[model samples]
Target: MWSLWGLLLCEALLPIVVISVQVLSKVGDTVLLVAECPPGFQVREAIWRSLWPSEELLATLFRGSLETLYHSRFLGRVQLHSNLSLELGPLKTGDSGNFSVLMVDTGGQTWTQTLNLKVYGAVPKPMVQVFTAATEEAQPPNTCQIFLSCWAPNMSDITYSWRREGTINVDVELHSLFSNGQVLSVSLGLGDKDVAYTCIASNPVSWDMATVIPWESCHHESASGKASYKDVLLVVIPISLFLILAGLFGAWHHGPCSGTNYLSVPDDF
Candidate 1:
């Protein structure tokens, strides 16, 4: 009779030990699961496993899957195995979320565990680039309308302004400001002949500037009939005199009449 009682006690304790072991072994995201087993029989086949959420939500928001999010194969559909650990890469504001793991055992058991990953970091500084016409080429004349442009990578929304170093009137019209910090076109009407112009571009985070010197009008007066006659006389007279003097000097230096010896005159004719 005592042996029968001992056997009953052992049987009750065995189920409790098995349940405790199974619960302790479960370490990852807990999944709620249902186990189908024989009635009145202790079942050890049913176990809790970790669940990995489908990357659909992450893909919808960030346009990438979990593998791309973590930058490693650490957070997707991990089987229940020993030493199960997840390594997430550099986290961003988009990475913060409540993630769950769903598990299903062979005995029709299902369970889930939720994990809230909090990610924090700074956003990278925007790449800035200033653009304008090459300096080697002749720019448009200042008298006519001229355009100056500035650009930045990944930025479209920008503001543009024109400034001069010296006193000069500048007529400007802002054409377009993009959403990503870029200046499309800026027109300037400059009347002054010798004026320096500067185009400045600014955004919420940074700013850039470009300087340009437009082609100027020639200051020389136009040639007229009277002016042409005067110019010809002024140049031709000096050149003609110089050539005459040079010819005379050469003849005197090398001619028979040259030197101190005089021509012999006949004593008797």
Candidate 2:
């Protein structure tokens, strides 16, 4: 009688064992693997062995079991749950590989499913650059024409515009607004005066703007001819005064000598 009861109990537990093993499955970013155990049996431990393991299994397995006896050698492993979801955080290029999930039953039965994992890395940031006209020597009036431009290293599809400093005016006179960037040129007239100007470049991904001011553009030549005339008058006035003094001295000395000779001649008569 006891033997018959034992046989009946074994039969009842068989279906449970099968159901437990069938429910083991997981979804991951890089890989998808499913593990199953018998219905009546629970997973005592889970193990994963990878041909090229990125991180140690002991460190990667947070919630699930990682026992030596239950551990299985696979490219990837995931824990079994009612709704199995494995979020392989921030995947790298090297994370791509074949993966499998191993679930060990209390009765020592193991089940595993193989999956192929493809990892995709995130895109890199775009490179930005500022372009401008050539720098020239400082002229007398310090005036020159300026050109502003912007570009990206690897990206071709971009948009650009120009902005001026301390003004509400937007510049629309661009030489060329290419698929990559834009170029703007303006005739900057400068003197000794101080002023400011700016250029702005932008795109969908990023924006870069630069400002420049040729302060010498505002200079005006103060009436230079009037200054030259005043200098000439200063030199001529001093020379005229010296000539008048010399003539007066010669006349005075000769007049005295002539008067003395006339008086002596009258005495002889």
Candidate 1 regions exceeding 4 Å error are 1-143, 168-191, 216-269
Candidate 1's residue-wise lDDT over 1-269, tens digit each? 35223333433444332221111111133322122222443322222222233342211001111222322223453222221223333333344444433322234233333455543332223333333332223556532333334443443445656565466353443244454333434333445456555656654444667665542312211224458879999999998787777666655655666567643332321
Q: Give the CA lDDT, 0 to 100, for residue 228 in model 2.
A: 71
C-alpha RMSD (angstroms) for model 1: 20.3
CA RMSD of all predictions = 20.3, 21.3
| TM, every model | 0.23, 0.26
Lowest-lDDT window of 10 residues in candidate 1?
58-67
The top-ranked prediction according to TM-score is 2
- lDDT at position 204, candidate 1: 42
Candidate 2: which stretches are off by over 4 Å? 1-143, 154-156, 174-181, 191-201, 214-269
| Candidates' C-alpha lDDT | 0.38, 0.42
lDDT of 1: 0.38
